[model samples]
Target chain A: MNPRTSMMQGNIAVAEGAIAAGCRFFAGYPITPSTEIAEHLARSLPLLGGRFMQMEDEIAAMGAVIGASLGGMKSMTATSGPGFSLKQENIGYASITETPVVIVNVMRGGPSTGIPTLPSQGDVMQARWGTHGDHPIIVLTPAGVREAFDMTVQAFNFSERFRVPVILLLDEIIGHVHEKVTLPDPEDLVVIDRKKPTVPPEEYLPFEIDETMVPAMANFGEGYRYHVTGLVHDQTGFPTMDEVKIEMMLNRLHGKLDKYADEIIQVEETGTEDAEIGIICYGSSARSARQAMRELRDEGIPVGMLRIKTMWPFPTDRIRAFADRVSHLVVPELNLGQIAHEVEHASCDRAEVVRVNRITGDPIHPEEIVQKIKECR
Target chain B: MDYQKYLRNENFPHIWCSGCGAGIALKAILRAIDDLGIEQDDVAMVSGIGCSSRTTGYVDFNTIHTTHGRPLTFATGLKMARPDMTVLVVTGDGDATAIGGNHLIHAARRNIDMTVILYNNNIYGMTGGQASPTTPLGDIGTTAPFGAVENTFDISGLVIAAGAAYVARCTAFHAKLLDDLIRKGIEKKGFSLIEVMAPCPTAYGKLNKKGSGAKMILDQKDAAVRIAKAEKMTAEELEEKIVIGVLVDRDIPEYIQSCDAAVAQAMNARNGSA
Candidate 1:
């Protein structure tokens, strides 16, 4: 069976999908679980006239992608929890400056390099709050290998299309899992390119606002030159301290993500049409939730699984939609109730939801998730 | 001629005082970038938040004004992604040594192929001149109103100890020499840390009786030692002065060179195995 309609591990498909989407620059520092991504990119990037650099450390590795993206390349860097922690500052800058880049966070046991070789989804909150400030962010989580590939491509597409940093949140299980990946000729893929300014170089403000909210980005040599700062700035991209300007810039930073919520937020629901219990989870937990939901439905418990594709600027509306119908919702994650908070916030006192939290550097068992769903039932 | 064209003219005069070392350092960086014949596009200048970090707007390039003292971090991603491009990291004494000091050592330890021009004014240029990591003991600044009690850090010595492949010291007194060192730092293959000894006459200089900018330059020039004499000088004789010029240059494994080699070997083995 081909990838057209066959099962594939999420990580393999992500690697394949990234290649399919024309990602040419891959720089990473090795960490467990995510190491395969570096290995795969190292092997594949060179074959497609691209480059991969195993940086001295994760910090430099992430920095390399930031520089490469500005160099007019679709650059990506992968790391697990500790490495992701190191990349947070740059990721924040990427958000503030609207730099188009992709970061694949194959989260593992963390807080301080907890477990390098095991699977854990403990970075759910760090993915959104690790970096400082109130800048806008976009995160995409893949439930499986197909999404690993499709999401990597989507992460790149979203980064370019929106001119923001897009994160592909994968867990160690999804990152290291081996499966057959479907790859097609690159020419056939819908490669999303950044919106370059058609305005003349002199007239082009690098971060000048237009109708899209995201400014028209210009290549380095193309001459529409302006400054980009991590500080809150106005339409010109210069650092501004004016209170009004700060508010406007902050609003724009948030608006670019929140205003276009319908276009940006993504999710998949199974058996939700008549389900009494809703299972909410993401990353590798989404996989467990799906399996558990399957087992529960077979037992005729009337349960559904909501797999969140977009993690940050989350599938809030979807959770709200589910709130109108489901009597109870359950969130099982490797961390202490991160997405559960989002679910609770989105549920808005409509549905009774609780968290199943774990931090043992192990995956949530499908049976455990199903049991949680049943308990809610 | 059009310094304004190469600069964000609107943010002119900068946040620097009448005689700030970071501003001069910024000029040297731009001159070096222009001297190398690197296109504005082919070069990127990154800075963390500080008076020196503010230099990102002073030079025209694909610039990123990054968070505090993490310019090296951002530059790392930029250079790794586009190895073909020249990446420069401009930071100040406190930013590189205090807050972002971890990155400074790691970058040096890795000997990554990027030029880090550290503007060492011996005082935090922003937040009203605080005591920096490099602030000599007993030197008074805004924060050290009762005199800096910490031992001064020798930047060149620190970089060498941190495993930087290219380590050099230059002062604002030696602008031409410092500029040349900055250029050489850029041309280097491994991690190059050119610690520029700059003056903050309005802040540290004024309080420490370091004299006006001209006098400060003259003082530095008087005390400056060449590498030959610097090596010859007895430890006791060099207590109060600095030995300027290229202090350290040795071959080390550059980040990309090692990575490229590993990638080649892995691919060859895979092919051979297949």
Candidate 2:
């Protein structure tokens, strides 16, 4: 067999990426812009001796992914806006129970199934705060088909390492766009598996932590015979209402991600050195921002672009430094200034922040971003 | 059977109130597992939110207490991924028939290889006497102060119609029968459902003027009749009685087997085309 560049859609790349990352289980419902992911996996996974199930709904999909993760398989699910909303509760369940899984939310216009075929980055904040409570989350946004493939593999790596659900946020345009790309060989990719317990079955505690605050997980039917619950629990994984135990549990759950922020956060920057204007964006908007910056730079304007790959664990410190150096920041998003507020808060009044937002089921055009950069400069 | 060996002794005295039938159901489940000689490591005990769901915590297995009405879905995933292991689900009436009704019907329809033990106490015991989908008509609860007007569900019958391979109904009062039914359900290769009619002395009993736990259990013993005997009775004669025993038991192609076969065929077809 000879290798050649194959034309592939972003969603197909994601499914291939998951399979390369050793994802053995996928359960999801059909939703617009994300349905191709399920379709591809449904055809591909079974051939690789992996399981693919189209669950009854998005909630069940999330639940099944969590269960499959507990069964010692890397598992994933995909859906769109309304389905993403339905999955929040189980997402929270996975967070509290510390189950490793991946969720792909192909962004579409919404508040309730607004536009199925159109592109919008409206779920950025919902991806962070959609699930109730103060649990830790990791979300990644990809700007192109290749990044969708690369970041999906990264999402699984992060989920396995941190034992948290990693969200791969893709907009409708990126998800549906066809691009020619060389798929990476599986042998060259870095894959991480969850750490298993070293102790004997009689001595194992499912929630017992070491210095890392992450307990080694034992798969079901592995003789550990441990209990896992959504309730706040102690090192033993049983339900606990004790104030001290609850506080300790919450602190560890939040602290593990916070401690590894340096390893978890990824940001791509261009021309930020000695620039007068910095355009900060992610997802599909980042494509426009990059184009706008290139055009403005050609006109002898000091415009820079910072594209965020890891959306949550927000990269506040990097943004703060960029804010301090630049005179103004331009944030272009599909929604009405959702992540712009995060940029403003991270800037801490050091730079003037300009919000360029659109919600008309359309992608932000490079011209609009260029206009914002020129006006802000 | 040495049922105590299956329990997490330090986690006791359990949170169940005096005269609660959850303890009885738990004991029966443990006894059934012990009788069947199933290894603890091979059993994945799953449950949803409720008083009955808390049984996962006390049992020494690979237990998972999930969100309300969602254990079967989770169990389905686990079983699909690890078909060699036995997955069992424990749910309450409200957890199974109210919020999780869709999952129940679909799980049965798929005939997935898992056993579901639905603890039907007729009221939301943990939430303090609210009416559930299994609450009988004219039964009083906190949400049904003027007496419940809604009809109750026939859980076993519904699963039987939904294509479960094994379906049975037994009460907490009939401990041996319940144990035997659970064992039979667990041994089945496809979806098996055993609806355990437990009593909630603090909730259902108090609200419905059923005296104490003992009195309610006595009521169950009096009202219960074998399916064979009940078949001979007319609708009017059987109106007040509860049918107990296996309602359905049949040989069927299990879901996991079908899924594996389908995958094999698809792979073969892809290879052929390639």
**Which CAPRI category fits model 1?**
acceptable
- Kindly report the interface RMSD of candidate 1, rounded to 1 decimal: 2.8
Worst 10 residues of 1 chain A by lDDT: A2-11
After TM-score superposition, the amount by which residue B212's alpha carbon in candidate 2 deviates from its true location, in angstroms, is 0.5
lDDT for position A149 in model 2: 94
Q: What is the TM-score of each candidate against the true structure?
A: 0.89, 0.98
| Candidate with the greatest lDDT versus the true structure | 2
lDDT of 2 by residue, A1-377 (tens): 33836888999989989998899899999999999999999888887889999888888898898998899989999999999999999999999999999999999997797988999999999999999998899999999888899999999999999888899999998899899888777788898899898989888878776679888999998888889899989988988889998888888899999989999999998899868899899988998888898899899999877888899989899999999999898999999999889999999999999999999998899999888777775
Candidate 2 residues lying further than 4 Å off, grouped into runs, are A1-4, B270-274
TM-score of chain B of each: 0.94, 0.97
Candidate 2, position B257, lDDT: 96
Identify the candidate with maximal TM-score: 2
lDDT of 1 by residue, A222-243 (tens): 4555666878788878878899
TM-score of chain A for each candidate?
A: 0.93, 0.98
